[model samples]
Target chain A: MRNYQEILDTLIDVSKHPLRQVKEFKARTGHKAIGCFPEYVPSELVYAAGMFPVGLWGGSVENSRAKEYVPAFCCYVLMSDLEYGLNGTYKDIDAVIIPSLCDTLKCLGQNFKVAVPSIKHIQFTYPQMRKIEAGVTFLESEYGRVLAALEEICGTKVTDKAISEAINVFNDNRRALRRFVGLASEHTDVITPVIRHAVIKSGFFMEKPQHTALVNELCDALSALPVSKKGKRVLLTGIMADDDAMLNILTDNGLAIAVDDLAQETRQFRYDVPSEGGSAMHRLAMWWQIFEGCSLAYDPEKKRIDMILEDVDKYDAKGVIVCMMKFCDPEEYDYPLLKDALEKKGVPCLYMEIDQKAEAQAQTRIQAFSEIL
Target chain B: MYTIGIDIGSTACKAVALKDGKEIVGSSIIQTGTGTSGPGRVYEDVFKAAGLMPEGVSRIVVTGYGRLTFEKADNQISELSCHAKGVHFLMPQARTIIDIGGQDAKALKLSPAGTLTGFVMNDKCAAGTGRFLDVMAKILEVDVGELAELSSRSTERISISNVCTVFAESEVISQLAAGKKREDIAAGIHMSVANRVAGLARRVGIEPDVVLTGGVAQNLGVIRAMSEILEMNILPAPMPQLTGALGAAIFAYDEAIKLK
Candidate 1:
């Protein structure tokens, strides 16, 4: 029997250094890797092109040069990514795909093109008028452009069958991840919040099918065990929760993440591509249209509150924690509204400001919030 | 029985002891000089003032930025929770709180019972904090404690719109070089901090009877600016620096009784 510790340790290492993982995947498989920035970017097209869709959720990098291109008010993730791209850290990527989701992202997309001249940037906008035929129609056209861009960069013709297969692989991967999140919370002793994040984040570095296989195995190992720990089960919502420091603090405070609405984690996989839709490209576009509840992705009706309330109930979570990303306009704008609605329902929510540096203040905040829970 | 709480802000450390969980027996506030020794020094100082032995304390709770490092604490709470708890205990009618400490500023809304309803903290910047004013005071060759008085005497208030502390400092220097009065520049700094904090308060939807705590609560200039901007009378805690420690002591007492 494979030890879960060994498996998780190996995966955590993979998730920690995505650039090295991408280079390794490229060297081992003799294939190219494409960069996908945070929030939403349809990686299925890249996967269908027989390439790795490497997630570029920013890290602790030197932001000195990034200031030359973008303002300091941008989110930490974008700043780090800009720093890497400008400094040639991401020079090896064949093409970078950016989803111009919010204001900062839109500016970053333009800056990336000018700064990283060597890499091809496949930029597309996700329609905010989703939930309507017009939105789907616009997104389908956008997907077509992205498909063409991928074909141009990869110098290979991607077929309908290949995309359909890629969609199936992603759907299965999403199911496994969705299942494993619940299992991780149940078996917090075995799968701490850090370990769970590692297991989920590693998927962005590997092929979708391979990720699915590993997650299924992890779920099996977790389910075979008893509830090894007891604590407050809470839902985490934010752009990203990849900070190991923050996760360790949560563990110390005895708060288990029952599930997350983080864009870097479950939020990326929540909506599976609909197979009943027209073409694989259409289905991929339909996936974006059907997606809801992210601070990004534009919901005029603000259904995220309902989704969060529903998630708390469904997961039997005691409360919600907002890993508030620093300088993220969309998330910042939604915070007051989200808090107001949560207050009305008498639900407890705590906001922790996340940034590049790990401050000692976060520990006290997390501990205090956990006490109330 | 005695209950103790220690608060470690970025600039200073505070210790407070409560007897029977009602009256504050004693409190001490001093700079967080160097390392692990600050908590111990403040602890001893508070104990000496109370004329009590530390061994008799029923429980000890710690809150603030350095609370996690205070190993002697029986319980640790967030500065946000501690501030709310302390203000609730100090001024029972305080439904909102604005606390400006060493590293950051926060505006927290509370229930009539003093429970924290919601809060908005400063972004990852030093502008809306005591540290921001300290740097500006140093630049102007003035003591930080005297900034409120200096600004109050300003004939005309200048505008310091930059939110970044480093930029704000440079802007202040240029303004001085551009023949701007130090008092007016000081007033601008106060307005800048006040506006930033007031924006945070509005985000949390300030309720009536707001209480102000932390080191900045003692600054009358900031208080005046906050009043003008928030358009509400912001009350200050009698000993704003020890509020977090007091709140922790309250929690320590409550938890101690429950355990017994």
Candidate 2:
């Protein structure tokens, strides 16, 4: 059996080179890979269609051709995604699934069609009012459309049993991740911020069941050891906190991420599809309804703020770090209210803007935050 | 025991030596910082001024941009915490602090007990910083130190609409070409910086008994404009630029005490 460090090293390598993962997986498994864009795109359908589901969270690439398609004000993630597609970095991707979680994503999907005509584009809009029956029904139909698109790309009919199996695989991965993150908080000396992020992000590149097995083994290995003393525990809330430079600053300041509301990390695995409710597509739609505490998912009461506050108390976090994604409208709109809520509750919060193209300058602010903690 | 604190900022390096954590023994400020040899020079200058050998110092704490790079320091602390400690030592009643450095502007909220409770900073922009004033001074053909005097003599208020340093430089050149008086343009530049800094201060929710500490605080014109914009009297700290260094020294003293 592999040790936890060995497992962690593999995850980190997979995260650092996702393109390599995709190529190796395709070559090994003889499978087509479908690219899924940020926030949410149902990858289970692609898995059911017998294809690899690759996550296209924007990378650290220079923007040149994408400039023609997107305005300079677009968020770095979408801009880089477009740049990758335009520059043929995602040429191996058979079909790209784009969700209209925000305005920039909508433009990205449209631009992907025109700019990267070599690859296929599949676009879907998530319902903002996901709590009600109408929203569920609408999303179920949308999932049907996505399933149809994936089936067309792979030239295979997706059976309900395959999707159910795929859902089981994904649910197992989520459960493994939930356990790993909890165990990670207790073993931060081993799982630094970067390691924690890599462990979670590597799930995006690997087959779900394989990732699940590795995470479960790692969690068991961690559970065998004694819980380490807590350091300066901090809760991170944002669209994402995967940047190496920012994560290095957190580690340098001796801050351990006790929990996170990051859309890319915890947000992806926090909710599972109901095993016994309606059809497989209906179950996926229900998963959307159950999903709370996301800026993209509209909630009138802003339950995300309350959830964050609770996480801070539960995890004994000294403060909260708001990794604001630059030009991200949904996250930007939610920040002021979140700040107000955290302040009223007497929780210290630091807001740091995460821009892929911008230089790293969060050192002073994060250091000061650590001092106060 | 003598504790030393050094702050290597973007454009200035400051050092302060404290005796037994209560009394200031010596302080020095050098106008160069960061990429230059300012850190080494300030370290030597502070010990010389204090009439103490480096070996006799109980602890050395560094702050600001160059803190990480300076190898001689025993400990490193953030400028924000150091500023809070320094300000609280000087004036315990201060609840809010606005610090404008070479390339960044920050607003810090303090508790009644002088603990730093909250803070906000400008994001990778030089518009609200000391560099903004330097650029304006160079374009206007005057020394940066003379900006306050020049702005005070202005009879009219000219507005600089652009807050971006590059665009604002172009705007300033346009005003000069259009034959606007240098004093009015200088006054406009101060207001622009004041407005930018005030925006950051408002984000952190400025409280009463507000104090300003930084190299930029030495400019009386900026203080006047900031006071008007914030709608509150802004007190400039005595030896404003030394606050970060003093705070570092205080931290060093505390660290030494803990060791003992």
Candidate 3:
């Protein structure tokens, strides 16, 4: 079996230095990289178009130039994205695909052209009424537009067969990640919060097949080890939990993330595209229709609450930590309802505001939450 | 057996010593906290006041923002759990606790048995904390302690609408420029803090027999405003600043017993 520590270290290095990974991928594959913005931009289209797809979830960069483009109150993720673009951090990416999932993201799409200008920008809107037939058609057409833009950039027509194969690759990767997360929960002593996040996050910068193989190997290694006694388990739900310092606070307090519903992590892979849908693009769009329990996904029934409670029960979580991204309106709106439902069920919830630029003062709160648990 | 608890908060360092985990032996409060000499100073002061040396103490538990930095602590607990324990000991009937410390404000829900059920805290903002009051008092050119008396004299209500501390300070200056009474502004400042804190309390779905702790609990003006807003009697902890330290001491005592 492959050494899980070596695999984890490799994934962590990729997560920590995404630009280096991007450079290496470009040099190794000899293909252009396409940037995909957060919450939901389909990367399969880029993969099918014979190009690389990279996730643009922003970085911990200082924001002097981005402040002039976007307002100061915009979410830190988008601000850092703009900061990276303006600062030439994402200059190598040929084009960026931005989805209008929230108001700030819509604004970021418009601002990207003015701020960056060097890289081409492709923007699409996800249908909010996704369960309807027309909504699925609309999303398919949106994905088609994004694909056409990618084809123009790459100068290669993306075939349906290629798209189908790309979906298979992504689906396999998602399954491997789900397995890894479940196994990681049973092995917290081996998988600290930082290491768990790095392993998942490295997928953003890696090819899907490569990430799947590494994750599968790591999972095998983890399963071969004896199941250690579990520590304090908690569920994290929000836009993202990407900050290393904040995650360290959780580890310092002996809190292990049993599971997470974060947009940047598990939310991307909880559901896979149906292989038997009408078309490859339609199947990809149908994946969104079936997706539930996300703040940005427009579920009026508030399935996220039920989903969170179920995960808490299933994983035997002692509490739920809402890693509320600062200035993230969708996540902010979902918090009160989530908190009430959790309280009704007697599940302790901790609301933590996550800011990429701010110092982590989460130690006191996490320690206190551990005590409560 | 003697046990000690130390709370090194944002602006203050407090310590409490307990005899056999029940009787209060000694306590100390220093005006400074982390990034200064406050932790060590308070530790020495508590031992001195207790008429005991460091060697006599069985265990040392620390809480608050600076808890991790206090090297002598046997273990560190969160101020929320500590505050709940301390308040439960002082007021057994308390079901909700609103603590406004130097930098943050938190509202904690408690079971009838004094266990922490839920909690909500202000996020990286000073508007609902003791630091807000200190800034307002400086802007008003009055001692922070005098705000309670000044607010009591207000004949008319003044509203401070801004939730940001810097913006609120500017608004307070504008109010003073408009010849508003200092007492009315003082009342308005207290009401602003009370509103912010009460919103946090409501998040946890406040239960009755609510008690207030932290250094800000010592301010009657805030207490009166909070009571009016929450529409519940708010009992002040007997020694507001020492509650966290006291709770840490209780935890220390419990741990010592377990070790034995």
- Candidate 3 at B138: error in angstroms? 1.7
Looking at model 1 chain A, report the run of 10 residues with the lowest lDDT sum. A357-366
Query: Which parts of model 3 have CA positions greater than 4 angstroms off?
Result: A357-360
| Per-model TM against the reference | 0.91, 0.98, 0.97
RMSD of each: 2.9, 1.2, 1.5
Sort the predicted structures by lDDT, highest score first.
2, 3, 1
lDDT of 1 at A55: 86
lDDT value for model 3:
0.91
Residue lDDT tens for model 2, B1-260: 99999999999999999999999999999999998989889999999999999889999999998889999999999999999999999999999999998888889999998889988888877999999999999999999999999999999999985369999999999999999999999999999999999999999998889999999999999999999999999999998999999999999999999999
lDDT of each: 0.86, 0.91, 0.91
Candidate number with the higher DockQ (1 or 2): 2
Q: Can you give the lDDT of residue A120 in candidate 2?
A: 92
Error of 1 at A215 (Å): 0.6
Residue pairs with colliding backbones in model 2 are: none
Clashing pairs in 3: none
Q: Candidate 3 DockQ category? A: medium
Candidate 1 interface RMSD, angstroms, 1 decimal? 2.3
Tens digit per residue, CA lDDT, model 2, A273-293: 999887898998899999999
Fnat across every predicted model, in order = 0.43, 0.90, 0.86
